[model samples]
Target: MESSRNLKMKFDDLFDVLVKDLTENQPADTSPALKWFQQVLLYNVPHGKKNRGLTVVQSYEFLIGEKKEMSDEDFKITAVVGWCIELLQAFFLVSDDVMDHSITRRGRPCWYTVPGVGLIAMNDALYIESSVYKLLKKYIRNKPYYIDIVDLFHETIHQTIVGQCLDLLTSKEVNLDGFTLDRYNAIVKYKTAYYSFHLPVACAIYMVGINDERSHQLAKDILLKMGEYFQVQDDYLDCFGDPELTGKLGTDIEDNKCSWLIVQAWSKADNRQKEILKVNYGKPEECNLKMVKMVYEELNLRTVYEDYEAKSFQEISKLIEGIDSCLPKTMFNEFAKKIYKRNK
Candidate 1:
């Protein structure tokens, strides 16, 4: 695997340039407000593992192959596009923390919880989202594929919001009487897969001049499955990962999340086990969380996760094998390997 640290240093340099531009372009007298706005933007962005942004550069590299050398100007432009994806991610996460009533993100206080930010964090989130388009227009507007890139950004945000709506709706309708595997899959695909896994690479493909329908469809098919496995692993980690390393306690059980574990447990549970889940899950107390974990252990949820992890790896391998190597396999393969057994 390539060093994520090395990729991240390059991203940080790109991020610094963007911030400097935003700062330098502010109104002469009201620089303080710009500083605050910039601070909010910078703080919220750049804290992730940089996998999404790096996927853009790596995918572009794969697509271009050896035909064209990556010019310094090319690297800078692609890095900006990658940063736009990161900004979009920040937009969702800030608002999501508020919606989830989460207290922390990336190990700091959630933006809404910071003193003096409060509900304004909602606007701040929007500002981050707007910056994505602004940067896109600034850097890529003259390119022949400019319209396609703009359309992609809009489509990705729309899909993510729709998925989020499904997720919120599912949590509200957790009657278990109505829960089914299909519904669970729908929630996963929309809420988690599209933006996290598909959109970033798709954006790079468009940049690399591979905007044809067939190429897009091929990338989406593989990326969406990768997205599913990514979220499934995330669901698994919530229960079993080290909190010291993962940086948060598992909340899916208490939040009544439509996680793979819960879905599987519900599917296989007897009537009595179902009743226990109904009574104990989502109770908003430590004791209730303990009860839920107990039930999970009783159901051998660990083994279930292990089984799924192995199966997901195999599925991804098969998908990659089916891909024509003429396409950018290294880019997608790099992403797949990083998340396959990620601990944090």
Candidate 2:
């Protein structure tokens, strides 16, 4: 019911409260561990667009009807759930950056890459993760859904970490023989989709008192598909998207990432093209990079991506249509619109 600007401001206020509360709970005064925790929390948690956090608030409001008045207390609780999702994301990304040996995030240095931080960022990531439970307990301890929410977060966390393990191991493999669409879907579904897409809406569902197993499972089915599509687009963009718009240069090529483009390109390559890719796919040198791109261009991978994008939208739209009336279809529709045709 509040304007988007007002809602965002409120979300920030609740987030600050959680941060301050968590900071107070940490060890007293100037300790290195405390300082590391504070620094990691500030840099990684709040730096993103906060889409996951905002989605909780937005989905709750949409489900309950924006025309319905929202109390300040209820709004704050909902916002806290959103912030919890952000914290979960921070937890994953900090560890992910370290694992991937990434250098930057959101156009800034990765937390681990920060001078004097280094491997400690992994532990800081743990602190960020632990903060989620801290906030949930402080705010939602007495709520009926507390156990359910905690369980959901734990399960999602487990799923994501498992997905990350799959991704890390898959990336480490030298041969392209293992890179297939099935593996790509598995990695994305676990590593990115669960936390990014499903967790936020599912949290809001619990908050809004939709606890029926059928409804929850239906939502999961719909959202996980959307999540998979979201990651596919991410893979596509990492290779073909504009760096300025995407906020970072594409590195999936050099990183030997199991990207959608790579899979599609591999599937379509002639023997010569396959030989070219074999010679040059994962090398970091400029000539190798150029050769890989040459293969992509020759195979018209860009057009393939366009066609795939169109089909993904159609499939997801049909899924949205099939969502039961007991659930708010518009909530899913709104989320789909946000991600549909996204370039960044």
Candidate 3:
């Protein structure tokens, strides 16, 4: 993998081009609506690690072979499509912060939390979403797979919305009964996996002229499973990881999130442990947080997580091994390795 510095430089270049294209045609008068729209795009669309967007370009290069020479236009178009995926992510995140009542994102105040922005962030989120198609039409409307690309984006966004709805319902009520492993899988697969893992690679696949129905389904199967494991690790890290390394303190316990740790701890708890959890699991108080952590330790949930990681790695390996060369196994392997054993 390239250094983060190199990756950031490349991604920033792509983002710069995208921002220019979006704003270059603005009227010279610069109306308030246009100004706010520019700020919305600038602030929300390009922040974060940008791994999801970067994956699209990287996966495509892997499929086409790094040694193979790609034209300047080919490279730029792939990078722009990658940025479009990032715009979609920005759309989800801006609205999610509003819905989740989150304070900060990427180390700054969320767009909605900024003074005077208020609920206007909702409309800004929609604008970011619409920009995805705008970028697509501007860059690749003439490509053979243009319609397929549009359809894939539409489907991925819809799947993520379904996952978000499930997550909202799960977290809407603070009942422990609702936090099941099955529900957790559903939420992660749709909300996080489809867009993060499946969409990027699927776009690359379609771009490279490999559109076999069976191949797409097989790739989805592998990627969706990888996405589930990726999210389970995210849940584990949210509660158990070091805040210094993670860049944010975990609120899953206090927030009553349907986290993997809680479910595992619940399943392993004794009667007294269960009662302790019942009293303290979702409380915002420091003592309640302490009590939940104590129970998690008693249940050895960290070890359980370590074991799950091993099992998941093995499963993904076996699946990748079984894949025929419809798409390059190396492409999927590279993607999987990035998420495997990640701490943040």
Candidate 4:
């Protein structure tokens, strides 16, 4: 827990530096567009817990053994690149909130919902997108792996958009008759796993000069599994976690998310249960939440989550053991341990 706190503090400092640089580099003259861009970058990027960006630094430290201390210059450059990924996440979330009609994020008003910021948040999201490339070019251009990093980021964004499209399409289709375990996994991998988990760690691996196809493929395989586990836990927490700890009320049921818990519950439910879910799952009403949660409790969804959590931990341990000890095991293992039983 202490290590996790330190990692979070490091991420916060990096975010602050990146935001300061963005503001300073903006045009000196005061203009609404410039002001809006600054506000968008600041407000949206810094709101989250910064897990994604910190994963880069943590993975880098893992790959390049912490025994080999990083220079201040190297640490600063890596931190800046990590912050770039967070900025990209902000770009996606701001636009996604509009498309999803999300009213709040991280327990606060969504960027679009803020005063005088409606609709303009779309362009602000774009500004955040542009900033990612600018930071990449500035910090990584001279490295031999620069092109790979750029291509990876582009491919990741493309995959996430594809996943997002599938998600939107599924919500509208409304016929749960088509939903399957395979489709749910596909959406989770592309839409959530790749960016949330793979992109960050892979970026760090590339920075540490591990661009070999075999090494990257191995790293991605391990990281994607971790990503899946993380998202599964997130889905479980949405319904089961304390709102005070989670910072928002659970909405996966209300939103009809194709989450892991829903997929599992649907698989085991009887026809009668399925009908009840179809009617109540996605409706935005207080009574509907009660109905869906009742179904989850009746099915003992918490027990299912416990079983999955145990299996995921074991599988991750196997993956870690298989990794060549020549690489930094402690760093990767540290990351794995931090996330394995997280409560908040």
TM-score of each: 0.95, 0.96, 0.94, 0.93
Q: List runs of model 2 lying over 4 Å from the truth.
A: none
Residue range 201-291, candidate 1, lDDT tens digits: 8887878777578778888888889989888888888888887777666677777777788788888888888888898776788888887
Instruction: Give the alpha carbon lDDT tens digit for every residue of 57-152 in model 3.
Output: 777777778667656676677888889999999999999888877776776788998999999999999989998998999999999999999999
Q: What digit string (tens of lDDT, one per residue) describes model 2 on residues 1-344?
A: 67889888878877667778887666566576666667678888887889899998888888888567777887888889899999999999889888888777777888888888899888888888998998999999999999999999999999999998888887776888788989988999998889999999999899889999999888898889899888888888887788767766677888888888888888888899999998888788989989999999999988888888889888888988998657888888888888988988
**Which of 1 and 2 is ahead in lDDT?**
2
Q: Which candidate number would show the highest TM-score if scored against the true structure? A: 2
Give candidate 3's error at residue 159 in angstroms.
0.8
| Residue 277 lDDT in candidate 4 | 85
Write down the RMSD of all candidates, one decimal each.
1.8, 1.5, 1.9, 2.2
- Model 3 CA lDDT for position 123: 94
Against the reference, the lDDT scores of all candidates come to: 0.81, 0.86, 0.85, 0.80
- Residue pairs whose backbone atoms clash in candidate 2: none
Clashes of each: 0, 0, 0, 0
lDDT of 4 by residue, 109-215 (tens): 88898998889889888889988998888777988878988998999999999988877777665867656778777887888889988898888888888767877
lDDT of 4 at 195: 93
Q: Return model 4's CA RMSD, one decimal.
A: 2.2
